[model samples]
Target: MAKLTVERLKKQFGTSIAVDELTLEVAQGEMVALLGPSGCGKTTTLRMIAGFVAPTSGRMLLGGNDITRVPPHVRETGLVFQSYALFPHMTVAENVGFGLEMRGVSRAQRGPLIAEALGLVRLSHLADRFPKQMSGGQQQRVALARALAISPKLFLLDEPLSNLDAKLRAEVRTEIRSLQQRLGLTTLIVTHDREEALTMADRLVVMEGGRVRQVGSARELYEEPRDAFVAEFVGRCNLLPATREDDERVRTRGGLLLSSRRRADESSSASTLAIRPERIAIEPGHHAEIKGQLEAVTYLGAHTEYQVLLGESERVVVTRPTPVRDDPMLSVRTNDPVSLTWDTEAPRLIPETAKD
Candidate 1:
């Protein structure tokens, strides 16, 4: 609906800084997710965008218009909260039409608009039901419908699907993504859940300690994290302590040499290495780089997980897609000798601290 530009956005609650020098841009009709752990300033950042919280310093531009000082009601941005925030006494249609009503639209004008919004969320059949009469998923959809009724330029959701059960959460997120795309709506989602952000957003902005950590596509953030915090936060990673060896290599503590990406901005040439568990392959040949004993095996429906004990103190976890044909891992036992290795380019070496 609109391009959102947040420049040098900073917020301080007295002496405690909530968001520091944060800057990000969301393209028109693109969905971006603010992903992080609890208390990472994601919610605060969303509030500032919604104009509910004042920024100590910064500017917010919506569709080339400055909305930094605009009142929330007049910002022309639709916001949906985690709690749904629907009135219990009102029926579904009434709740969806409430925004239009507040804008002084007549009852005749609100009917089709409310119906269209409800249809977008597939809740037209439940228009007469109250919040207490519907499931968590249904209630949340109603909240989404209500937000869309105003035809706002920017759509914002703060943990919008967190209240639903796991199955419902997965189902609803897909529905929301499809709906947003169909309407070409510019949307921003705030989520702590990794898979939710990975699946729903076109791009991700990982934040921590009142600052942006890394921003990229889901694959970039997962496979090419800029720092250790991002590597561990975005996905399953096996972090190994290593000594840097020249420009593109690191020697592990156990004397295993591995290739890694080295950055020039890094003060130290060498740093800790991050390797995804799924990238590690189990080799049948005895000449594999690292030898270990398979400590445990877990059989997930789609993937088989292996826990291999490397040396005495370090254990590496590997997850591989289940083969179409049944294999040895199905009958694999603990304490079996095995060798693990990975491609040269899969491992990423990142600094202990982020580059300014």
Candidate 2:
């Protein structure tokens, strides 16, 4: 395991800046995920760390050793690309032992280690099978075994599960996480899938426009997003225009007063109120501070999503666990007058400057 550090990293291609002044630290044996949408510089950052793309500026350190100028082969970093980059003609054992061969390990010295690597991924029985004969998941495991056989200081995966089908992806994801935990490897995974990042990472680094937006654990980011971008990117969020009051309260556009931690700062010129759909409660009576007519209802498996049009200017979406079929209070119809209420602690205030 190794502690990886990147300081003020930058990369550019002609007039386009791919990565900009990004800096982060991954502690030894920690699993850190770089998460963002396409073109957010996640892959670029990964490549820089693997030494496939040299940074235009900044430095990289591994285990407190300066490795900014080292070549990819010398960096001792193992990379598993999105496509299973296995040799088509080589059998499982051959592929797993290829790294050892390149490093000049004798054939006798590589056999048991190769077998152990295949067994670690549960591919020991198919050691003689070629890549074409194996399933996608099996081939992926072979790739993983190949990377592990090299005993790298840092393990870097670039969307390794993207190519698998949905079901296989889920299964293989759990297997990979379990293996990483058991081995206690310091790993960095770059992925566009938000759920994958949220579930697998010990800490997440969210990026946008070639810069780091926020870095926190899943619970911290989900419960308290620093800005609109982080809130909306990590999960579903309802953003409503709001103004700060003299008493440190936030007033929504529908004239609903919501308690907030503090007023928006001067940089927060376009402040808005953000709330999760699950936080809103749907009731029949008129006790709600905000009322709206139901516009649409979507029946999800565990929950029902309701879209409510508040007055004429604002729309709020709320989701609640589906009620029993016999429950009369929740069998709501379109255009029905409904009351929506939420806990004062639920609404989060966003400064105008923080609005994305």
- Which candidate's TM-score is highest? 2
* Cα lDDT of model 1 by residue, 193-227, tens digit: 99999999999999998899999999999987888
Among these predicted structures, which one has the highest lDDT?
1
Q: Give the C-alpha lDDT of model 1.
A: 0.88
Evaluated at residue 157, the lDDT of candidate 2 is 92
Candidate RMSDs in Å, in order, are 2.1, 2.2
TM-score of candidate 1 on Cα atoms, chains taken together: 0.93
Worst 10-residue lDDT window for candidate 2 reads 261-270
Model 2 steric clash pairs: 268-352, 268-353, 269-352, 270-352, 271-352
TM-score for each model: 0.93, 0.94
Query: Candidate 1: where is the Cα deviation over 4 Å?
Result: 259-270, 284-286, 322-332
Per-candidate clashes, comma-separated: 1, 5
Clashing pairs in 1: 1-186
